[model samples]
Target: MPAAANLAVMDIPTPQEALRKLLLERLRPLVETPGRAQKPCGMQFRGTQLFSYCCFTTERIAAFETLQAVIGIVLNGTKEFWVGNSGRRFSAGQVFVLPAGTKLDVVNIPDDRRGRYEALIVEVHHLPPALAALPELPQPAARETRHDVTLTAELVDALSHAAHTLASSDHAEILAEHRLAEVLMLLRNDPAARCLFDLSLRERIARMVVAETTRTWTAEAIAAKLGMGASTLRRHLTQDGTALREVLATARMQIARGMLERGEANVSTAAEAAGYASRSHFIRRYRSIYGAVPSEHLAR
Candidate 1:
């Protein structure tokens, strides 16, 4: 067997597990150089050569520089990233690719005063020239464009699954290379995929805010947590056509409704769980948005 093939089937059981374990092992030798953050579940490993992490934390400032390419998926939460001379923001259900030699920084902002945010990060050595040589992607002129390419959920799920599979070792380098190629092909067809090859700053803030009517948060507190001046944050979001408060309310109501439908919690419980301080307040918002009372909606 080829050396990589031999390494592939060695002692691993499932393909997914083997790939992840092997990556962890390989990364073990490189932890000292560039440094690594704590790994979240589903992230196989971190090493000097390659690293991945998933984070859901209160708003804070973070910065890093890499000599390698980085691809990130924002599964749930908003991230504003600064790359070299450009900056871009991404929200839940979005994906971003950063080229090698890019200086990157991210800050998470919560529409509600809750200060909760999350994202996934994946970094690999520079894309091979062969990969970069694929046909150029067309995008709106940077001067007129405001949003980065939005990746479909299907593509995101596929990439996530592939990354999980790669964490296992059942495949040889050829197989691994093929899987990576598949991901590149998907990006090639996506309008937003060009950003992966050429590094640029893209900014995206949430179009909607989600807040619990019952929970009260001071503007100063919210502004400080997001690392933005209160006035500035409000102005930007307002210009987007929705007030921050409206976004927060919509988000919380959606969560409440989902919980109620799942039968995981009753009206009162679901309301509070969704960040309402009082059942009455929750019910009021719920009725206003859904045209039915929380209990009535749950009954169905």
Candidate 2:
């Protein structure tokens, strides 16, 4: 892969490609100076569809969590998946089906060959029309809401192909939708997967926040739009372990990071979209979350 500025869609990294590069970078890690972005890895995301993308991991990480339902494919290496005190180890080719707001601790064990741990994770935003219209998934004798999903061989293959082609394909979003549709097919057949689709109102609010990052949203305003009182909405978010501001920032950061990763916008434009009046402020916050200022992508 060339410098990010020189690399077009053709040079974007697939999951496997990402893993390889991450390992190589680790051998000669770039030093991160204060107030400057780290050296850019050729690890560009192909698109901002929000429904799909690839993620690269090179070191051990823990306390991984987010507010999006994700379908994750383990491209290489085994990783420990911990839900509370109980823990389990899963290896390459296994899939992680996690509902929104579920918290899991993960520790990556790099494969000796690649020296990287990679997973391509696709976030499920609003329910696609296909899944929304789907009847509830089947139920076992003992019923419970599902929090995680198991991967099947067919799903693994489809998602692997999606990651492989995503970096080079012009139709990244389309490929993602196709893969997501396959996920929906799986969900339709499995009651456990479908149960994750019972997205909570708090999650709904979070999606709305993500969708409308530019809007100056307050709890009162959101409640008004949702036909509820401000205090009630606050209580709901509190129960979900978030607040109006936190949700707003989380949503804005996702969109902002996507815009930067796809090379869709410079830092200034992304700042505006994130509802910040100051580019410097946005950069500081962006660096805090992403470990780099956004503009550094072009410098690479």
Candidate 3:
């Protein structure tokens, strides 16, 4: 069959249909039985192949768990996923891994009411027999950690180009296999990489503080909420190579920068929304940390 001119631009009405289309397009050659129907609003990527698609809705428990072993990238929107039987939440930016056979539930909360839950889901089943023969796949960490990693525009562009290339060329499958391995390696090597699937209560609370960048948070307050002592909280953050305040500041700045880039807020508004009491303070701090003023940074 001939490929659609704008195959990547189609607005699949439902998540199930979208997954179905994606499988038919990307994984038809790998699976023995490729014509099976997916559960309502969901699709399966069978066998050993790489498949990618954008999801546009809040996914429930059953729906989310369907892609249990897949690794996904968050182009936009927040996804709250769980690992194992733990009751904790994990939210990340840009790229993150969803452990194999891990039950994940995602909620897409956009700043704007009209915002849709958009993500690029990539599934790779083609591992060399030798690589696949490892005793066990990388399992989720026992404790969850929060990371602040830089996702440069160059990296995003590279991923987009790779995805486009995979969708268009006959060598798409081969290219995807290589690219997915590269991405996984990059993430595995990152010092800040955290396990999204196995977060603890304390870690979840800490993540919540980070996610709500607008709130003016204090160690004592956060500790109180988590039912931990300020000293204990410091100990936990110390293990992560930075203090609680630094992490909080970084999180706020990251959110502010994203909001400014998206034109969701202007300089002062972004600063204030990120919990800065004064515009001057925000600008000075932003410049010191990011090496550029808010306006200059946003202009790029």
Query: Across residues 80-184, which tens digit of lDDT does each residue of candidate 3 receive?
Result: 655555443423234555533344554554324424443445543323233323343356555446433334444444445455545555677566656655544
Q: Which residue pairs come into collision in candidate 3? A: none
In model 1, which regions exceed 4 Å deviation? 1-56, 83-87, 109-116, 124-147, 172-174, 189-191, 198-300
Model 2: per-residue lDDT, tens digit, 21-98? 443233212112267433223233333332222223544446665545666555556667677787766555555566
Question: Residue 188 in candidate 2 has what lDDT?
Answer: 54
Q: What is the lDDT of candidate 3?
A: 0.51
Model 2: runs farther than 4 Å from truth? 1-58, 112-115, 135-157, 188-196, 208-250, 253-270, 278-300
Ranked candidates, highest lDDT first: 2, 1, 3
- Which candidate leads in lDDT? 2
**Residue 44 C-alpha lDDT in model 1:** 29
Give the per-residue lDDT of model 1 (tens digit) for 1-300.
667765544553664344433433333332222443533322324322223433446454545443235566554457787656677887654557765444567676643442345444554433334664555455555533444544444454556554654555555233545555667667765555555554321111111122223445555555654456879777867776766666555555655675575455798788776678899988887888667788875734
- State the C-alpha lDDT per candidate: 0.52, 0.60, 0.51
What is the lDDT, from 0 to 100, of the residue 16 in candidate 2? 46
